[model samples]
Target: MFLNNDLGPTLEKIFNDSDSLKSLSIALGNASIQNAQIIMGTVEISNISDLHQFVQCTVNFTSLTVELDDGAWVCVGPCQKNPNFCNQQGACQNEINGPHCKCHSSYFEKYYGAQCELYSRGAGFYAVLFGCLVAFALLIIVSAVMIVVFYRAKRTSSKKFELFEDDFFDFTSRGGYGHQNFSVTEDSINTTATEVTDEQR
Candidate 1:
């Protein structure tokens, strides 16, 4: 509907009211400019999301001018027509109609647009990875704490056993009523000697 030169001035009016267009592409054939030069290529646009944005694209002889960043773009593609197709945001796929941009997915971001120029970084993917790392760290910490506590408790038990052994053997050093120390005397030998002499005499 937009290709008709008869539609003419309605181009600005029709596109200026873009309310729901995410992407747009236009190719002009035998399109004439009244007094100005001619454009031989297509115009492509990756517009603002859910907002009205306008860009001007024009071609004069060999010099081409178009919106580079925001609005109307006079560049078109079929993959091989432009090496930097899809703005390098995605790989270009040549279809029967033209080139289609296949947006690539990443762990941290999702892409939009045929150029894949528009994107929103997602936290969910990175959040899950970060959460796993945190969980692993906590597990390591808990394991280390348990090992230290076990070794400390074992060392304390050994010290208690040593103290118990010392206390148990300490009783042998003190005298008790059940224990006695005796002395062997020389008088018994003297009595035996005297009896032997008397028997001999």
Candidate 2:
């Protein structure tokens, strides 16, 4: 049973053989399955900094007292109280030594501390970094392939154009089409002239 603020003598205790209850007095500051059996069966003395040895919720077997203040009892592990002692995003866990904070996600963002507050890097971060590097490498390779293909295609086209120019030569060059034989010989010209003179005579 957790006795909180009203650590007073207002309640009576009765023991019977027919129906009996036995209790042990021990100090625990954090919540646990074993401690949380009753009202989150954890007790804490909330004051620390001022060197104030006691708080309002102090209790003993014969009496109870409450001197309420800001530093009143709030349960933590045997030595702590504030659950957010483990940063806001972490869950406070009771360990044998003291309270520990477990991070919500270890893969994406690493958290480490007594309260799980400090971090360096996580596995997910490294994965993303690696993925980005691979993508960049692939992009460079593809660009290089495209450039090589374009250059080869351009070079091949230029060679084909040079061959076509050589085959055409030029209309006015030494091998022009007009230089080939396409008219009659001198013997035919003389025969025609003689026949004309005979007709005239």
Candidate 3:
């Protein structure tokens, strides 16, 4: 039998009389009353016990049903049932359809997966992060090596050019005197040739 209204008064009468019912078990359905609105979910119940304590307990009943079991009537009350439908990293929200799993606010930053299981800074993230770090380090090392090589090459080239400049200056100074002697020899040869031609004429 399901009792929709007069739940509190009927339960009060049952609890007032101890001999009215025995071995009564309340299978509280998975429905709750919040702000005069009924939210339904899975069904849950409590162990068979005396109705005195249940009547005193503050339980919002959405559906009250009675069942006969072993010659005793069991009056089931509305129990707050926790379906735990939410995921490991989420909390369950009771909606019109059913319980919905929603990720916590703290998980919004890095977690976004089927059940909010994946994190942004997970293994893949670390792998890419380390790869970038290694690449940057290698770039710095390569740049340093190039700078060193360039510096050494520049220094070697400067030294070679300095040595060549010294040799060229030395050769030019020596070659100037040799060129003057060659010019003098050529002039004497020309004068001798001119006298011989005059004799022949």
Candidate 4:
């Protein structure tokens, strides 16, 4: 009579007790059914927390149970608020190394701005340098052309002046004097000289 009362007669009532026993059974069964082991962990405190912090929390589980059904075992580790721990392109509060951010090797983080950002080599650096070089080259080419043109022009002008001086001197001498007396006197002297020579002979 007492045993009957202790075990409830109703199926719903019995199931309520059975469910609680099944949870314990499952936990115990998981250890033997799959190869499982506990994970060890440690923590570092950068600043003392005013609120309570977790020393450790552990739960029994089958470590060998493939999570994705592809032979990869479940991961057991300390709890973290951020999910981007393993992502190379993402940042997380749970970053293993540096601050609460994770950056790819090619990137860097600025302390004042966005926690994680891509480092950029500014376009202005190349633009200014290249612009200066182009300007310098243009200046050199223009200067060289100007020097060549100036020298050629000076040489041509000097030659022209020399020609003009020679022409002026020739025109100002006897041929350009245009005097009729000078020619007549020169011809009479020539004739007198010839007569004297003849008389002497």
Candidate 5:
């Protein structure tokens, strides 16, 4: 049957005797007293042994209406006899939720269990930036090497330049000087012949 603070005195009477609270679920709400609340839920007793056996109870005293860690109302289960049990001071911490228990502040939850861990955000950005810089430097170095190789290849494959003196002078002078000399000689001869003929006549 669901039990609230209204039936508090009666529930205590049940707890006074050694009784097992099995298959029992409870919820507490802050009312009347600041930071204090009442639990309400039903207890199912299967056999006579259950009535005498004590089932664990969870109590929550939280200012936050909704818990950020578990997305449930914050509550603490009863102190467990197991040394590994989570609620040491009858206080439930955020990490373990309700099912498991956590150790000290240094510990974090893993799939298998909780272990000491170090928190670091430095590795992420540094790795990416370092990789980019290395790649860029390699690209620049390869490009420079390729450019040098191409320059050397082009210089080696080019045809040689040759200059001949005769060819250069012929191009600059246009006509041959020997042909002009021959024309001058012919003119002189013709003039002499005309002069001799006139004298003879």
Candidate 6:
């Protein structure tokens, strides 16, 4: 017989009266059994006049929560949403902490974007373009240098030819045999001398 205003003492007495039910509650509390169900059947009591009864009970279990390495707690269960929540070319994964997006393995190396669709042509294209530019610059510089060298050589050769002509003309003038009228003057002087000698004879 149990009489109490406190519900704890009344519940203890009721649980002590049933060994099987107490064992089941203990098993459920320790997480030994995950699920249970109850079914009602036709009741037959001995020497009962008018039986009217009402019973209600409430049970609570531990909430399933997981703590991540980042010190974040997340409820562990199936994702109620779609797995493809991430947009195009992206994949979604249900982690212990939460769901996240990851790029595909094919694009993992050189592709990056909101959808992992952008690709890089690597450094080779830029290297080739830079090499071509440098070659063109070198060609222009070499051509300019060659043109300058040829022009200087031609000017020096022209100066040498002019100097040789000047030297030749100076030498002919100093020898006194290159005057235009010297031969005519000498012939007239000889004619005069011969005339004078014949007269004397």
| TM-score top scorer | 2
**C-alpha lDDT of candidate 6 relative to the true structure:** 0.55
Better of 1 and 3 by lDDT: 1
Off by over 4 Å in 5: 1-120, 159-201
Instruction: After the best TM-score superposition of candidate 6, give how far the Cα of residue 13 lies from its true spot, in angstroms.
Output: 58
**Model 5: per-residue lDDT, tens digit, 1-201?**
233234766755554443222212122332222222335566454443343234322534322122223433332332222434442322334332333434333122222223223233345457777999999999999999999999988876662323544565554365555324334588899999999999999
lDDT of 4 at 165: 75
Provide TM-scores for the models.
Answer: 0.38, 0.47, 0.36, 0.32, 0.27, 0.35
Residue 154, candidate 4: how far off, in angstroms?
0.9
Ordered list by TM-score, greatest first? 2, 1, 3, 6, 4, 5
Q: Give the candidates in order of lDDT, highest first.
A: 1, 2, 6, 3, 4, 5
Q: Could you tell me the TM-score of candidate 4?
A: 0.32
lDDT of 2 by residue, 1-201 (tens): 124444422222222221222332222333221222223334454545333344443323222323334755433242234646767767866654555677666777877776677877778889999999999999999999999999999999998888778447655566565346568989999999999999999
What are the runs in model 3 whose C-alpha is more than 4 Å off?
1-120, 166-190, 195-201
Query: Candidate 2, which segments miss by more than 4 Å at Cα?
Result: 1-83, 94-97, 171-201
Please tell me which predicted candidate would have the highest lDDT against the true structure: 1
Query: Which stretches of candidate 4 lie above 4 Å from their native place?
Result: 1-120, 171-201
lDDT of the candidates, in the order given: 0.61, 0.58, 0.54, 0.49, 0.46, 0.55
Report the error of model 5 at residue 195, Å: 41
Cα miss at 182, model 4 (Å)? 8.5
lDDT of 1 by residue, 130-182 (tens): 99999999999999999999999999999888877745655555766334566
Can you tell me which runs of candidate 6 are displaced by over 4 Å?
1-110, 117-121, 170-172, 180-201
Error of 2 at 50 (Å): 22
lDDT of 2: 0.58
RMSD (CA, Å), each prediction: 18.4, 13.7, 16.7, 15.1, 16.6, 17.4
Model 1: how far residue 197 lies from native, Å: 22
Worst 10 residues of 1 by lDDT: 18-27
The candidate, 1 or 5, that scores higher on lDDT is 1
